[model samples]
Structure formats: C-alpha cells, structure tokens
Target: MTEPTGLGMSKVARILMVEDDEDDYILTSDSLEQLDSYQFDIHWVTNPKVAVEKLSQEEFDICLLDFQLGAQSGLDVLRQAIKLGCMTPIIMLTGQDDDNLDKLAQDAGAVDYINKEDISTGRFARAIRYALARNEVASERLERLKAETQNRSKDRFLAHLSHELRTPLTSILGYTELLLQGEKAKESRSELNIILSNGKHLLSLLNDVLDLSKIAADKLELNPSEINLDSFIADVFYLLQINAQDKGLSLVITAPQALPERIRADSTRLRQILINLSYNAIKFTDHGQVAIKLWTEWVEQKELLFFEVADTGIGIPAERLASIFKPFEQVEDIVTRKEGGAGLGLAICTELARRMGGELSVESELGKGSRFRFAIEPGDISDVPRSELHFVKADTNQDNEHYDPLQGRVLVVDDAPDIRQLVQKICDGFGLQVVTAENGLQAVQMCNESLSLDTPFTLVLMDIHMPVLGGRQAIAQIREAGFTAPVIALTAAALKGVKRSLVDIGFSDVLHKPINKKALYQCMSMHLAAQESGEQIDEVEPHILLVEDDVDAAEVSKMLLESLGAKVTLAFTGAECLAVLQSSLPVCKILLDLHLPDTDGLSLAAQIRTISPELEIVVVSGAQIEASQLSALNISRSLLKPLNLSTLQSLID
Candidate 1:
C-alpha cells in the first residue's frame, strides 16, 4: 500500500528543507511552527543532489528549497526531482524579489515561490497549504490517466487476440464448409460436420467471453432495431430446441394472441439473454420440460411484456441464488460440473436484461426447478414500418436456388493462404475466374495493371491486416488512383465502430473473418454480378428413418418433415429401426436417437451401419453428442432435440 502524504487532512505535515544557510532554515521552520492549523516535522538537507534524491524517493507533504545553494543551483534540484517523477509539493525559497526569477522558479516545476524576506506564518502557511492541495489533485489526475491508458491497452490486446484466434478458425471452418458443400459432401460430410460444429461452438464461446470483457469495462454496445416479436420468440425457441431434446425435455413457448407484434429493442442481445437463460435451465434440469411464457403488465401508462423461462430442473438453493448471477459463479454439484460451462450464462443473461431497460429475477425450489423472469416495454405496431416485414423466410430449397452468369473475374487478396484459396474456391464455385494477391500492396498493383490493360477486376476481397500494406491504406491508394471496384474488407476484428470506420475509410463493405460462407456469398453477390442462382430443379423427396423414443415429439417432427415433402418412416425403438433398415425401403438417411427403452442408441446405430454401410445416420438426442460417438457409429451428424423444420428440411432435402 502507498503511504498517505497528508492529503489535506488535519495532521502533522512532513517537510524537507534544502537550504545551505542555517539561519534561513531556522527562520523558515519557525514560521511553519507558528501556524495554528498544522504541526510540522522538518528534515534538513543541505546538498542539492541529496535534496533531489530525497524529493524523488521520500514521501513528504511538501519541500522547501533555497534559490541559491552556496555553489549548487536549487533550480537543478527541482528539475531533477520532477524528471524523476516526484509527486511531493515543492516551494522555491528566494532572497531576491525579481519577477523574472519567480516566474522561472515556478515554471521549473515548483508549486510556489516564497521570498525569505517576507517570511511570515500566515503567508508561508498559505503557500504550503495551496501547494499540498494542488499536488494531491495532480496526483489523483495522473492516477486516473494511467488507469485509462491501461484500459485502452487492454481493449487493444483483446482485439489483437481476437484477430489471431479467428485467423486459424477461419481456415478450419472455411474448408469444412467447402467440403460439406462439395460434390463428395455425402462421403466426408459426417467428419467435416464435427469440425464445423465444434468450430462454431468455439466461436460462440469466444464471443461470450469477449462480451464479458466488454461488459466489465462498460464498453458493451447494443444495436437496437424495431423487431417483430413473432420472429424473435420463434428464433429463440428454434435455437434451443436441441438442448431440450438432448434430455427428452419439451421446449415450449406460450404467448397470448393479444401480445404485441413488434418491439423496439436490441433483438440480438434480447435473443442472447433468452438463449442463455433457457440453456442454463436445460443444463441444470435432468427431466420434464422448459417453457417460455409471455404476458403483459401495464404500469405507469407503459405497456411492459413479462417473459418467463421456467424449467423442471434441479433448482438453486436460496443462499447461493444471489451469487449465481455473478461472473464465474456456479452451483457446486456433480451435475453442474459434468454439464460443463464457464458459469457465465446466467450472469451474462441477467446483465443483458438489466442493460436493456429491464430487470431479470429468478425464483426456485431446490429440487423442483427454476423460473427466470424479466420485463421490457413493448412498442406499438407503428414501431414497425410497412416496408419492414416481420417474417422473411429464406429459400432453403436448394433446387429453387440459382445464380446468373458472372460478367467479370474477382481478385482475392489475403495474407493467409488458406483464406485466399478458400475464397478462390468459393469464387470458382460461383463460376467466376479469380485472381489472387498476398497483400493490399499486391492488390493495388494488380488492380492498376488490370485497369491499364482495359480488363479491371470486378471485385476485390481485401484482407485488413497485411505485411507490406494494410487494407485501409492500400484501398485509399486504390481509390485515389480512380479504381472504383467494390473492395470488401475481410477482417477478424469485430471491434465496435469497425464496420462504419472501414466504410468511412474507402471499403465498400465489410466481411468479418471465421468466414461465414453464406454471408460471404451474399456480400459478394451484392456487389458482383452473380452469374447463376441455383436453377430450379425437380424436388427429390428424401426417404428418412426417424428413430425417436418420444412418440408425440416424433410424430410432430415426422409431420413437419412430410410437410417439407419428405417420405418419413418413424421407428419408436432401436429394434424397430433395424427392422426397417433391413427391409428394401430406400432409406437414404436415419435420424437416430441415443436414448431408447429397448436398446442402446449407439448399439442400434452400429447395427444399422453393419447392415447397410452406405446409409447415412444422424443422431437426434437430448444428451451432449461427442465427436468420438459420431465417429464410432458412422453417424453423419447429430441434431439436437426439437429440430427446427427448415434445418431438418435442408439436411434431408
């Protein structure tokens, strides 16, 4: 701990006096002693160098220095002490009353200039008190500035680290997706699916941790929009349906018909809060169900919608409930440890809700499960514009998707070989001949060369950070030279204001790293003339063998698949699955469940694979599925319980 240096308190002042004359020192000490406001402890140092050392190293309330130190300069001592980072209050004592000398003394780092001839208790004490007080204020400001500098450094470090992490992850996820989207996707997709799933999971974990860091620093930013309540609730339920199914639990949502259709809020953050809370509920609960209920409460003339996520899981004990919302806090139990989390879900959820003009509260019985609730003001229908539709469904039907012919080639620029090649592959798939550049410097040169030859590149996918030249500077050079092709920034940095800043700095658009293939395609298509959208083809009805233990859930899922035009054959038990596979039914895919009353789900999968080695098997269960388990059973991929129809349709079709 740092020692207190009499920071304006009614206490004894520790003073250091550097004066060669014994008579002057005695006179100055007597003046300070006559002050009724303070007691003084004076230490005398005659040597200028010693005075400098003492001021620099010792903790004192104030220092009194003589202008002339017999053959040494008092000004030299003050300069040296200040240079050495002294925080003590320093007052220069002078025999001469020259205005120039007083100004010089004050400018040389002294808090005040006091004349020896005008030595009086009141005047000396006034100067001493003011110096001490100003010094304390300066010290506090310095500390605060140092703290701010450290925080900025920390944010920069996180950004750099995020970039480094996302670089390799981009390669991993990029190649995995490419392979999955390839002609031989049927052959290697199962193994690649593991890599893709885990890679995305790791990304989510990274984002969650980064969110905590930003929130702790009070820098977490929210982008609010007029969101359709219908879509928001559907998405939350769709995302977490798997978690509920992993343990044979029902994930349900109940909202009144009178519920508002739209709300002005940060939909992404709101979704994150619900997902985290509901996932936490599923993690702690061993059986039963997780339900999301919505109602309205009007208070103070404002319409507030109350959302409750209740689960029949092992609930929190009363004492520990308070700390459960704290970062890195978790209930100490075998289930919690085994379920595995960084104990950040609930903490982040509660904070997110509070930050969004709402408060999250929870109630639980130790063994009966928990109910998490929060409320937010719902906006009226006028919040959403007519042009803005609430639900815009994507054409997941690959058969109906088509691309037009490309009119020009693209330039793929990146320092990473993996990314450049990955993008090249994607561009090639888009039926556009692609050129490559290692950095922005190379990109600028190639772009100019192409333009000079009357064959300028159509679009430039530029990496932000490169060795020879960074994307921002290079793009500026390109734009200055009159190259007007759309140059999209491919970066790993997702720092706040990055996109807008990039746009301001000449980038046409921004495509973040750990490259989402779909997002990249969309971004590219917006600028480049897309050659061919997937042409409409005759629909191929997938013959699926869905083996689920819950008959009701299975029936609902089967109907959804059939509605998507799939010929679904449902099996309630593992034995029933084998019997179907043994029959001459053209079963292209099998959605297997790990939990079944008759036999082990894994054993059943192994049996089916042995009977028909070419048949694709997908696991649908509530428990966490491991890569090793999938590899062992020759399982293509595992879908979490309560499958979203679009995701299921895309997988089967």
Candidate 2:
C-alpha cells in the first residue's frame, strides 16, 4: 500500500461506516485512520437507516458494515444501498463468529467480510481498498451486460418492423400499378397517389432503420473514394433544402474560399452524418435559420476539417444534453408527438463520427440555440487544383427515353375474347399483323391451311390452359410434328415449377401475365433479332410469341406487343398445334403457355428445346421461379405477374 502524501490526500478514498453501536463505529474509524499506507476518510453513522440515507446523498469510495446494529441489521442497510445503485465496495464486520449473519450480509450486497476481533488497522485498511476495487469491476460488468441486451432487443425490433412494412408496401405498389394502367377509376387516382407517397416514406424509414442497425453492429462498411468536398456538400444541401422548407426553416451553408478541391472519404457515410445533423436542426427549429459552417484546423500538426451545424431554436437543457446521444433518449417527452423519430439520429451520428477517427460535441443554452461540431483528418487532395472545380446542378425534370422495338408477326392465344381484342389493338398500334385463336385445335387448323397455301404462319402464341389441346401439349405436339420455332410461355401460374418446368418441357422463354407494352417490345426485340439472324427458327414465327390461358389477359398482352410493331398468331392448345404440325406445316416462332389443361408446360418446353436447341424459347408466367429450378431447366429470365413492359423488353431482347 502507498502512503498518503499531500497530493494523495487530496484524492484520498472516502469510506462510510454504518453501526448502531457508537463504540464499534469509533473503533472502525480509528483503525482505518491509523493505517500508515493509503489515505482514507471515514464517515460514521450510528443508525443503519441514516447510513443508507447518507449513501444516496453523496459519493463514497467504500462502505463498512456492523452486522448487529441494534434493532436494524446491517443486511437492511446493504439492501437499501444496493437498491439505490451505490456501487461502492462494502466490508461486513461481525462481533462474533456468526457465519450465518456474515453469509446474509455478503448475499445482501457486502463485497467482503471480516470478524470484529480480527480488525487490525492494517488488515482493515487493506480489506477496504480490496473491496472497493472489486466493486468497481462488478459494477462495470453489470453495465456492459445491460447494454448488450438492449442492443440485441433493438435489432430484433427493427428486423420485425421492416418485415411488417414490406408486406403492405408490396400490395400498395401492385394496386397502384393496376390503377396507373387505367384498370381503376380516375377518381381513385388521387387516393392511389397518396398511397404511393406514403409507401415511399415508409420505405425510406425502413432504409434508415437498416442503416442504423448496421452501424450499431459494426457492419456498416464505408467505401472511400476521391470526391470534391465542396460539390458533395452542395449536393447534400440541395437535397435537404426541401425538408428544411417544409418545416418553415431557413438553411444556410458557408464554406471557405479556398477549400480543398478533393478528399478521400466515404462520401455516403459523411453525407449521412451531415444529413442527420441538419435534419435534426431543421426539425427542432420552428423559426430562424439552420446554418452549416465548414472550416479547417491544425491538430497535432495534422490538417483536419471541421463541420458545425448551428440552429436558432429551442435549445436543450444542460443536464439533458449529455444524454441526447443515447439511443431512444430525446430532450422532450413529447418529441415523438411533435416531431416523429425513433430517437436514433444523434446516437447514430455520434457513432459515425467516432468511426471516422473523431468525435461529435455540442454546445447549447436553453431558450437560445445549439451548435454541434465534428472533426476529421483531411484526406490528401494536392493533386486536384482549384481551377478544376465546377458546379453541376441536378436536373429536376429529366425523363428516361422509352425503348421501342420493331414489331413483327405476333400471335395471341387464349380462351377469353376481351384479352384477345386488347392484345390485337396494342399490336395494331405498332403496325403488327395480329392473329388470334380460341383453342389449340383451331390454331393447328389455321397453320395447316396456311402451309397448304404455301404461306406458313409466322408465329404461334399458344395458351397454357384451354378447353382442348392446351398450350404445353400443343407446343410439344407442334415440335413432335417437325415444326421448329421459338416458343414464348405466357401464363398466370406463379408456382415455383411453372416457369422453369415450362422451359424444360419445350418453351423458349417465360413472361408473366398482365403484360406491359415496354416489356413486351423488349422481349420481342431480343429474341426476334436472334431468330432473324438466320438462326434455326422454330416452325412457328421466329420473332415473338405469347402464350396465356386467360382470354382477357392474353388479348391485352397481344395488344401491347403489337403496339411495338410485332405481328402475332394465337393458339389455344398443344394437341391442336400438334395436329397441324403432323400435317407438315412450317412455322417460325411459338409462344407456349405453361399451365395447359392437357400437360405440364415445363415438360413440353424441355421436349421442344431438345428438338430445337437453337430456337429461342421464353417462358411467360404469373409465378415466381426458384433459382434451383432455373438452374435445373437452364432458363435465365422470368417475369412476375402483371408484368411491366419495359422489364419484359429488357428480358427478351
């Protein structure tokens, strides 16, 4: 033990002694006072209740307890101290060798035990110091455990919330698509727009939650790249301007005249930190301005950049400012109601700054305003000259050009009349030759008649499920009868095997139901170009084919394709096409449906592919395909139900 010097006494450990017996209290205090080593100040309390009260009112280095304290026992005092989170070490003193009382006192919260008779000044002083050290270790352990448990709970909650949000959002986007396609009333469009906006906001919230969780778990990796700091800051400012304006707040940014032209940093993380701080400033400030100031400094002879965000608004109380960086801690209880947040913004910012080899600090005065600042080592930018700096404004109204493909002969086949008409109209818009059939039998007859007249059908769009000779069976039969053509599968079956299985059987490719014009054109352009390159075209039209079971759906899809300059032929079933092919009709391309009344679409697609591997077969269905099945069937692309035209065109082309 080290003896107390003038300096040591200034930092001397203080101990509190609790005992009902005045003599016992004096003896303990004197024993500790006589110690020639470490310095300590002992406060005595003859009443156990008073000792517990004193422990709460002030801080102490350790506690000494006498087990027998008149009517009140030392255990009662220990319990009270423990309940109040008095983490100071405690040594239990007993008059007699009562192991039971010692055990009780230790269990109640005492850090160690010593018999009163064994109380030498030297031994007592040593015991007090040892116990105090041990108590500090135990308290730290408990705090760490508590923090870990809390982090795990928060992560689980975020994951569950994300899952719940995605479910409803999917439906909202789906319905909105339907409405935008003119399937819903015009009056409901406004409501749909509102839903879309809210859905976007919800998605943004989910993204923030995920980002925060990743940061907390130390899994948020930054991709540092060379960036112009001035330009980067300007972009962040521009994006956050709308948010500030919405809150009726003014946002101002100030940068040095000769700022660094380039810096190597994680642009995304830096942007996130700035955005969070600025957003909070704007959120808290009901009026006045939120100003962002940038500057540089020399710390330890290292060039460092500092950013400060200050706002004129209601500031945080001094006492509460320390806790503002704690997760789920907000300055006001009504913060969730007045301004919505999970109280994670500042916490995340703090961690982010620490990760960047710096720390975040704040200064504020209640009823005035607050300023937050962080510093980071400036990255090398000596290679970039000031003259090269240029400001590029973002365009607000730029739109992507719609890609359109040349239309060729297309086929529409389904049991529904409305669908066929819809498809015909869309194809007609693009100057495509549109043909339709109710079932496989009718389709085979038309192909046979064309072959007899020396004018073979260009393409066959076969429906999967029809009254007779369904799409798959018709495709297989057409292949068996010696017709080599590309077959595209179009059906509403969203089962795992629906897409790949169709390709395996004989279809060239798969498309989903409720087709969009853009997707249709893209698909047609890709496969059509392949077939027209003098590649071995399947007996059906080599360019494009559509296979759908639903009549209205098939027609709509056909119309969309035709609107893109495609010619189409419709077929209802596999057997009907088989009959025609058996009669020696030569068609270029075939669009086969997956869910046929006669046979499985995948099996038919496989069989067809086996006969004509060079033929382009695309399966169009309303089902989601599994990666395993896709690998097994060797099919690359698949479209979901209510397919988007742009996506379709991309896949096929």
Candidate 3:
C-alpha cells in the first residue's frame, strides 16, 4: 500500500516478532511474506524486555515469540506482556517439540504454540488466525463463568430464603389444619378449608421455585432405589385419580401384566414427573380422559423404559409446542392464563430427565390432545427377587375412614406446643390413648417408665430436631434402655434422602410437616392394628426359642411372651440357639434378635433354616433392615424394637 491505512479500515495485520536469533527472525519474516489472507506489517523486537515494552506501548493484531530468546525464554516475555495488560493474542514458536514447554507457554498467556521445524507460510497464517479465535473464545468463557457464578449465588440465596419462608408456612398450615378439624360450624369449616387450600397452593409454588433454582444451579441429585414399576405407576395413578374425577375426567394406567418388577430409579423424581404431567392434563382438560401407559423400548442397542401421560385436553397448537418446555413461556392466550401456573413444571421436568440421562418430549395436535413422555435406560435397574406382591389399599384419606377403634397408647414428642397438642387431639379423636412430651429427653424418660409400668408405648412419634436432646440421641438412649416401640421421625425438613437417613438412624418411618392427618393416621394405624389383633389370640400359644444377648432384654422379652400365654426357651447366643435346635425339644417359633454376641442375626437365621426349614423365624432387632431385604434373607417377619407386646403375640401365634 502506498499509504498507511487505519486499523478499522485496513486488510493488513500488524504483527510483532520477538526473537533473539537473526536466522529465526529471517525465517519468520519470509513465512509472513507468503501469507495469502492479508498483508503483514512486522515490528521486530530482539530483546525480551523490549518485546514486552513494545507490546504495551503500541497496538498489534498478534505477537509471535520464540521459546528461546538468548538467555531468557519466551514464556517469561509472554508473562511480562500479560502482566503489562497487553490484550493482543500471542503465539509461541519453539525450536524443538516439547509438550511441557507448550503448556508452560499457554499458562503464561500464550494463545497458541508452534514448532519451528513445522513452520510454513500457510501454517504460520493458520496459527495466527487460530490464536486470535482462541483468545476471543477464552474471553467469552471467562465472562460466561462470571455470569454463571453470580446466577448461582442468587439461586443459593433464594433457596435459603425460601426454606426460611417455609418454616413459618409449615406452622400456619399446621394450625389451619388443627382448626379445620375442631371447627364444628359449617361456615367456619368451609372458611378453614379455603385457608388450608390456599396455604397448600402457596407451598407448592414455593417448592416449584426452589426446585427450579436447584436445577439451574446444578445442585439437584438423583437418588436411585429399587421400585416395583407396576406398583409405583399404579400408586401415582391412584393419587391423581381423585383430581381427574373432580374435573369430570377419567384417569387410567395401561401397562403389561409383567414389567421389570424392580427397576432402580429415583422414585421421588419419577413420582414428581408423573404428578406434574397428570395434574396438568387434568387441569387443562374440561372433560374427557387422561391415560398413563408405561412400556419399554429398545433404541440404539439400549433398553429404555418409557412413561407417557396422554391427555384429551385443550392441546397446544403445532407452532407453540416448541416453546412449551421453555421456562415461563406458556402460550400467551386467555385459556393458558386461566390455567394459573408459572410455566416452570415442564422446564424443571425436562432438566430433571436430562440430568438423569433421559429426555422429556411432547407431541400435540391443536384442539385434539397432548402426550408428554420421558424415557430412561435401565442401566440402574436392580434385580429384585421374584415373589408374590402384597398391595396395601391406598391410604390417601384414612383419617376420614371409619377405622376400628385405635386400641393402643401412643407417645407424641415435639418441641412445638401447638404441634404436640394437634397430634394429641387427632390421636384422641381416633380412640387412641395419647401421652405427650415436649422434647426428646422427656420422651425417652416416658418410654423407660412405660416399659417399667407394664404399659409399654405402642408407637412413638419423635421429632428429629428438639431442645435438650435430638430424636437420634433419644432413640439411641431408648434402645439402650431396651425400649423399641416403633419410633417414627416427625420433622418439617422435607429433604432428599431424609427418610432413608432417618430409618438408618433408628426411625421406623418418617412423617414430614405440616403433617397430613391422613398420612399420620395411616402410619399409626398400621402399628396399632397389630396391637389390637394381639389382644385377641385365636391360635394356640407358640412354643418359642427366644435368642437375645442382652440380659435385661432377654428377661423383658420372656415376660412379654409369657404374658401372651406362650412357652419361652431363652437362648443367649447363636451357639445356644443351635444347641437348643439340636435337641428333641419342639421349638415352634424362633424370635431371633439380629445382633448376637457370637454371630449376626442373618447368618443365625440362615443356619436355623438349614436345621428346621418350616420353623417360623421372627427377626427382632434395633437394626434397620428393609422389608425387601428381610424377604430375601428368608426371614418370615422382622420387627423393630422396643417391642410392641401385641405385635409380638400376633407374630408368635
């Protein structure tokens, strides 16, 4: 060019060459001279110190620095240029191939590196272009990371805020429920129901917001467990059936008779997905039906199980389907507005499916129907031993049911006076004798006294977090004191894996607050049924071989069993039980405590099976073993301690 052009108007690249060797400089100059893209204006700096100063003093499109510069290395100059706040992209030229030096050069802020042995006109030009592009990308990535960090901080703050908000909301809901139960006036009950309904709706909104935040921050985790696929889907359908009925729609579940009996999946998330889709279908549909079908498909050599919720509702127009899964992007129409959602359910579901190695998809026709489906590979599916499955009647509205008199005493422990009173009132209304404690310390003390007074607690509802002592420590003390009435954990913390953790830490079950009266009664009624049945013994008394290591425990158990009119032969260890079994004595039942001085309960049970396969084996222990696990071990029945006298009698009979 005859005249120098401004950078904004120029096709030439202003380049800086930093090298001490004259021959290397000449080679680089020759390479630049042959570039096809643009003309190069070279500014040569032989000294490393001058190179950094030149970079800081003048603007350049790109810089090429040799790895070896006399007594100094190009990495030092690259660092100096970066420290001087030079924004130009830098490429390092090395005489020999060294991956370590290349990494060092990049770490010192070099965008790209090339070996002098492989240098050519085209190669040199391509390196410059790549270096410039890489630098731009790095800058963009830094900005994106900063934005994400800020967004994550905001999400965490919101989640903490929402949890704090729920603490009071739980109390409000609890009191509202208590009032609704007590209010006899029709108008008062109606008003209370409205309050309870709105309270629950608000709680649902908060949960959805928190879930969205967790998913955005990538803090949501999968908790896979063995689930009976047929039962699980059936349960979900049953739950939503009422909703569909209220909306004048039919809810149905279609599945093959045989499914993967036990598929390992995050049952909670799966339930959440089904509930969201089914509820939405019912909500949007004025009439017609909602059907759920589960089947497996093999795709790309992978076995994927599919769950589909198809609704004959007001379907989305074909054009709007693309944006349905986008957060807060519901169809901008009067009907969608009337549906009343923040438009986050589908987005959250989509993210959850993707995180769990699955995909959520939809198919729709305007004014026809919509089908939302998600599928996951059975990589986590667990093989559950095949057995006859027992189905418990759905316990959705047990409090409203006409239950047989709750003929048992239950201990309710919580720090909240209102909560304690509420539980007491509910239990008393069901004809259950209720004793209340304000803290774990009192609960443990009461349990000890009850066992001593021959009025052992039928069930204990223990709060997890309380003053003086926590439920965990209290349960430990109670167990140490030989008290094992089933202790269910009552808490306001509905955290993931909390149920399993509570069970692991000596809880028979978990009830989240503000407690559902129906759920609480359902849980309590199951244990109480055993107590009520134990009162009337129809079968002949069982001759029992009771194996217990603890002296006090053995004596107490013997007394309890004898009270049921059963003959007891006490065995203090596994060896003692074997010795007794080897004899000609008729041992009709073996009540085995899992923890023994000589061997574990499982091994002892297995050994006993070999000796007498038909003998009834009742595993009584403080250990946490799931029902499925107990079944697999061939144990006929397992009971959690401190023992319920009535349950013991029924099991023995």
- Please report, in order, the local distance difference test score of every candidate based on alpha carbons: 0.78, 0.67, 0.76
**Candidate No. with top TM-score:** 1
Highest lDDT against the true fold, candidate: 1
**Candidate 3: 10-residue stretch with minimal lDDT:** 389-398
Candidate 1 overall lDDT versus native:
0.78
Off by over 4 Å in 3: 1-149, 172-200, 300-302, 331-336, 377-392, 399-653
Error of 3 at 80 (Å): 26
Query: Mind giving the per-residue lDDT tens digits that candidate 2 earns over 272-326?
Result: 7888888788878888999998876777876777899999978888878889998
**lDDT, candidate 3, 1-653, per-residue tens:** 11235454325667899988888889888887775455778888898889989988887878998998888878888888899899888999998888898888888888788999767756767887676556557667667778867885886577456646665666778777666545354567757766776787788777778788767655566878777765776677666777888888988777653457678778878777778888888888887899888777777876777889999888988878878888887643524678678888888888878766689999987778899999875564435443333333354312345656676788999887877887887788778889999899999889999997766788899877778998877876787687756778887655455565455445667887767777788888776665556642122233588999876689898999888878887888998888667643457889899999899999988889898888888898787788886787677888889987888868765
lDDT score, candidate 3: 0.76
Over 226-257, each residue of candidate 1 has an lDDT whose tens digit, in order, gives 87777677666766786689789999888653
Better of 1 and 3 by TM-score: 1
lDDT of 3 at 69: 87
